[model samples]
Target: MPTQNPRVNVVLDNFLYQNVRLLAEKDNVSLSAKVRDLLKEALEIQEDIALSAFAEKREKSWNDSETLTHDDVWS
Candidate 1:
C-alpha cells in the first residue's frame, strides 16, 4: 500500500536516534510520527519567537500620536 502523505528521509546520529526511538516507544507511536510531531512543535516555537521579536521591534517604534481610534478604523 502507498501512503498519501509526503515522506521525509533523515539521518540522525546514534544518540539522537536512540532518544527518538525511546520517545516513540513511550508514546506508543511510530518513529516517523514522533519526529513529525517534534518537528511541528519546533516550528511552532520558532514562529512564536520570530513573532515576539517582530512585536518588540514594532513596540520600540510605536507612536501614540500617529495612531487611530476604533471609530476611525471602522468608519
Candidate 2:
C-alpha cells in the first residue's frame, strides 16, 4: 500500500523543472514524489554534516580537558 503525504506548492525555474520532470518520468514516479525524495535526501545530508560537526566539537573539548588530583589542587 502507498502512503499519502502532504502536498506543497513550489516554484522552479523552467530548466530545473524540465530536468526534474524528466528524472521523474525516467524513474516512473510522480513529479511531486521525486521532488519529495530529493528534498528528503538533501535534508538527511545536511543533518549528517551537522552531527559530524557536533561530534568534532565534542572530541576537541574532551581532548582539551586537564585532569587534576585532589592533592594537585591543594598544592
Instruction: Point to the candidate with the largest lDDT.
Output: 1
Q: Write the per-residue lDDT of candidate 1 for residues 7-72, one digit (tens) a residue.
A: 889999999999999999999999999999999999999999999999999999999999999999
Q: What is candidate 2's lDDT per residue for 1-75, written digit by digit as tens?
A: 765966688999999999999999999999998999999999999999999999999887874258677898998
Clashes within 3 Å, all models in order: 0, 0
> What is the Cα-based lDDT of residue 51 in candidate 2?
100
Question: lDDT for every model?
Answer: 0.98, 0.92
User: What TM-score goes with each of the models?
Assistant: 0.85, 0.72
lDDT of 1: 0.98
